[model samples]
Target: MAKQAVIYKTEAGEREILRRYEEILAGWPVPAGRHHVPTREGDTFVLVSGPEDAPPLVLLHGSGSNAAMWAGDVAAWARHFRVHAVDMIGEPGLSARSRPPLDSTAYADWLDDVLDHFGLDSAAFTGASLGGWLALDYAIRRPRRVDRLAVLCPGGVGRQKFGFLFKVALYRPFGAWGLRRSIKAVAGVDPGDTPEVADYLTLMFTHFQPRRDRLPVFSDEALRGLAMPVKVIVGARDAMFDSAETARRVENTVPHAEVTVLPDVAHSIIGQTQPIMDFLTR
Candidate 1:
């Protein structure tokens, strides 16, 4: 038999990571509903919160993360808009393990099915890292379907940095201690500050295989075509992407875009719950 493809380093690792994921979900702050939406790629998991009658807002987490990433912001966001936090396929979530080509339209098609399932013609979007790239891709391809766009340290808009790989490699030999340091360097946050979060990330990186391909950069013409309101929040100290370039490109092409560069922040942007809500509700 041909070797089976898997995302986690081992089956046991998958179980442990998912077990912890479920634990986080069990403590979800607000009244939330979880379900799977059928798509061409596979079954997509969605965590729904907020009032059914409120305007729809979709949340996308960064790579190596799931819907639980929004646990801190959901309660505030859910109060105003109906929030649908989606687990991107192929990630370490309950979603399908289908890894499609980034250059292809497969992701957009899957999203189309997801929106259709929710009976939504258009909705606001908030995405981080790889999720940010997905949101930009969808908005560029299906502009009419995006009511508004918000991204945090998003890829595609700026050049992706490869220096972090060397840092990761240098720490690989150090075992768990080195892994934590590497995570801190890449994430721009001290993992030790939050033991629970640090533990989860360490567990995830130890097993999960992150994507290696470079994120496709958005062309100036494509960005200029985005008519919906756009907001981009990136950290100045980001080790993964060129934040200055990202700010410059967005400001030049997407004139209406609101760009905020946090002076001392890094790839892991935290404490933006109110700012994002203000953008969505405004």
Candidate 2:
């Protein structure tokens, strides 16, 4: 039988990506320890840090990114909470490359395994982009396990604009330069500003073959059903979706959800550490 295929375009590409991954992780600013949490699906890789007794906070990265992407915010977050930065399964991280069906509860189940492994009954959850969608999904399915929820430019809550897809496709043929331009347009900041994150995303985009799963939007019923406090932040200038519209939907559907639309920010909304921390702690 042929060897099982992974997300990368080729085995060599996977090796190269893994090499860069370790290099980026080694340069993590804050002190962290690696934990290869065993789950039913596979071994979930997590970066554990912060105080032993501090309130727990789980961090999930956007698509094509990994736990290392949280380097910018982990230090401050770790100060107030015990941080668990998880390299989402099947992404460009140390976690097993088992791509679970997006529409099913596979992700929720996998996360359940992770939380159980950590001996955590519940924890505050924060996720970016695709990770945000995952967090929301889990929270909706297992509300009692999520003490609080905060999301950054999450999908599944609003209509994804075709304009975003057109722009991304338009830039693909131009290679890395065009890809970087597209990324800048959506992410709102120059990739050069954060060279490590830029490099990692670029590498993953160049090498990895992302899953072609369609994410479903969360219904008003689901959003309104959330029992815990929910907070949402989006980039006013986000090209991927109508950030204002997203905020509106979240605000209207989830009456109690605190929504903030940051001016001049894009899909890759940054500079939200303080706002999210305030919400999480408050």
Candidate 3:
């Protein structure tokens, strides 16, 4: 028998992380419904919010995170669009641990199932980091199905940096303090997060094994083929990816793409609620 893929270090750790995840879901900030949609990959978890009549908008979170990352943005986004925050498979969420090959059509097929389940022929997409890569891959491979695309600090467009890995290695021996520093440095965010947010991040990284494979950068032809309205928001000081390169490429290849490079931001681009909504709605 094939050994089941284990995302958490131990069974107990998985349970605790899930317990905390559920706690966050309990206060999802809007009336929401949860679904475990079946797909070829495995059962995928989705947290649905907003009015049923609203236009469908799919939200994909970054690696080492889940749908819960949308807590602060959901309320506002829900008012405008029916939001389906997906827990990407193999991540730390309730999704299946079946990580298909990144260099294949498996993820696009998985998303096809997800959209089919939602009765959506197409939907607007917004993603961060790894999720951004997923959205871009899908948008490129299945352009007809993506009404619009907006990515924040997305991968695949920029060159993925490996220097953070060295920094992480250097800090691992320092214990929790080092972990916190690593998170701050890599995320390019200040260490002033609320206690709840800080605690949750610590819990996630402690147990979850993040994907180590490099993201496949999109070719210029693939990017130029994007027919849908595209918006790319990147941080100038991103530690994980070359944000400037991302901005330059997207701007040059997809001439119609609206790219924004925040001068002071890093990999973690927050407070984009209004901007993203405007792009999606406009």
Candidate 4:
């Protein structure tokens, strides 16, 4: 038989792929490293925790970040839950996408496939930044599949007056790079050494691919579709968009939902392991 075609990469792309994969592996916070497994969505990668039979919880990394942001909390939570930290499909890290999820519904459906592959009927979800946006939208689309939704400093909300050129800057080829700058621009704080924050932004821009054609929930007005448990956490010092406005939207949409504004916290709430734990535990 002829040699099988190398569909995963071209020869020149091997080094880049290897380096990126190494970064992905090294970026994780939990021990026993990462394990590769194929899911209906694609080759969904996971960082395992606790026992196999434990309650499953999915951790969604924010924009420009890998699953490693959940590092600190997983080891602690795994005692009660089988933590599965996922690299968002098509964005970056180890999610091998045959086709990128193209829109809000598609992303939701694809994520459902991932959950299904693990035989999980429902899970506790946590996401940050762009991941937060995805988590909320996913819960809205598939309310029964998620038990509780936690979003930290999520994006895709509000109508802000922006400098015309500045608005266009978000769409450039180097958008993730601009994304990091934009985040810094929004946070109003110096980017301190907050563990994986810088690495998160770097991978997001350089490795993760955003499908611009994909319509995000930010465009949608109806949040009533999501009836399951939902929680919104906005950083008091977020350099991102209007945190209070986003929090109010979740509260209004979910009705009787939990909303928290973290004081002295920046956009990377995942870095604040204890607060995240207390929120999830409660």
Q: List model 2 lDDT by residue over 165-280, tens digit each.
A: 67778898999988887777656658778765666677787889876776778888988888799999988887767777789888888889999888878877777888898999
> Which has the better lDDT: candidate 1, or candidate 4?
1
Q: What are the RMSD figures for all models against the true structure?
A: 2.0, 2.2, 1.4, 5.4
lDDT of model 2, residue 150: 97
Global lDDT of model 1:
0.92
Please, what is the TM-score per model?
0.97, 0.94, 0.97, 0.74
Residue-level lDDT tens digits of model 4 in 82-125: 88888776544666644444353666776877777778888889
**Per-residue lDDT over 1-282 for candidate 1, one digit per residue giving the tens place of the 0 to 100 score:** 112236799989999999999999999999999989988888889999999999999998998999978988999999999999999988899998888888888889989999999999999999999999999999999999999999999999888999999999999999999999998988876865777777888999999988877888989999999999999999999999999999999999999999999999999898999999899889
lDDT by residue for model 3 (34-121), tens: 9999988889999999999999999999998999889999999999999999999999999889887789998999999999998999
Report the number of clashing residue pairs per model: 0, 0, 0, 5
Q: Clashes in model 3: which pairs?
A: none
Ranking by lDDT: 1, 3, 2, 4
Q: Cα deviation of 219 in candidate 4 (Å)?
A: 7.9
- Model 4: how far residue 7 lies from native, Å: 16
Question: Which of candidates 2 and 3 reaches a greater TM-score?
Answer: 3
Q: For model 4, where is the 10-residue window of minimal lDDT?
A: 1-10
For model 4, what is the C-alpha lDDT against the true structure?
A: 0.63
Against the unseen true structure, what C-alpha lDDT does each candidate score? 0.92, 0.85, 0.91, 0.63
Best by lDDT: 1
